[model samples]
Target: MSSIKAIVDQKLILEKMEGKGGWTFARVPKTTANTGKSYGWKNLKGTVDGFKVECSLMPLNKEYWFMPVKAEIRKMVGKQAGDYIQVLLYAEIQELHTPEDFLLCLQDDPQAFEHYRKLPDDEKQKYIDWIFATVDEELQVQRMADAIDRLSRNEKLPKKVLSAGKPA
Candidate 1:
């Protein structure tokens, strides 16, 4: 874990490389840049301008790391480009919190449970996060059952999990 202070003063400029769209980013404070590199995209929990955010730092180049200031963060912080945003970051080892319903469904199917156990940590995290993102009880149950069915049949999940209200 590392801590440092710096201001945010970059514009949300879009970049293009030979006509391909690029990311919108804010540079990591120079003092904290090295810390992000050392962590190599590990989970980070920190406060930016008093707003709590959890995300992985992206390497911008050899000299800096950056985090995308998405529309949600921008609105929450109420700061625009060039504002002096304060940040305090700490590296964290996040534990996967699979939803209980999802786990129960998997537990009932031995084949699914076996395949799920074989998934890499990061892949498993995606499934858990997908479940966590579901806000409705009924949809969560359906998705869990769908996931288990796919796993049991050795079928791949969709590239991304569909929202609760969306069909899979």
Candidate 2:
């Protein structure tokens, strides 16, 4: 069972859900639990007991909501199920901008464009971010080309890389 009350102003919510193992890392405090409305999703940022995080506030079942905290975060925080930890968050919203060069490259291949469009906004943003996360223009160009090629092949990265536990 998960229990949390991540208090943000009205727009962001903090609630608990019924996930069997989600709550052990931290519980949203009960003091700010009863925020009036429920929304499908909200981007959240900040710390859960001073461990930095970027996560989502989302609904799980019919009656409640939860934050799906990552295992790495749980390990870093050194908390477990049934443990109580402080929750602090800020509602986050960001606009993703897909570079024109990427779009044009996609447009050159109908299948690639379709696959790219099918990707979630966050995934697309991550790809864009990764492509630009460098000072070497040559590497950035290579990554961009690789991204388009992989999309054309209907995959985020090559199968060999994934099978080898390597990230593209």
Candidate 1 accuracy as lDDT: 0.63
lDDT by residue for model 1 (80-164), tens: 5556566666654445566676788899999999999888666676567665566887866766777788889876667644444
Worst 10 residues of 1 by lDDT: 7-16
Cα lDDT of model 2 by residue, 2-105, tens digit: 23444542322223346765342233333343343454665667776688888765665555446666668767877655555566776534455788877887
TM-score of each: 0.46, 0.46
Query: In model 2, what are the clashing residue pairs, if there are any?
Result: 4-28, 5-28, 24-80, 24-81
Off by over 4 Å in 1: 1-57, 60-90, 160-167
Q: What does candidate 1 score on TM?
A: 0.46
Task: Give the C-alpha miss distance for residue 69 in model 2, angstroms.
Answer: 16
Residue-level error in angstroms, candidate 1, position 150: 1.6
TM-score of model 2 vs. true structure = 0.46
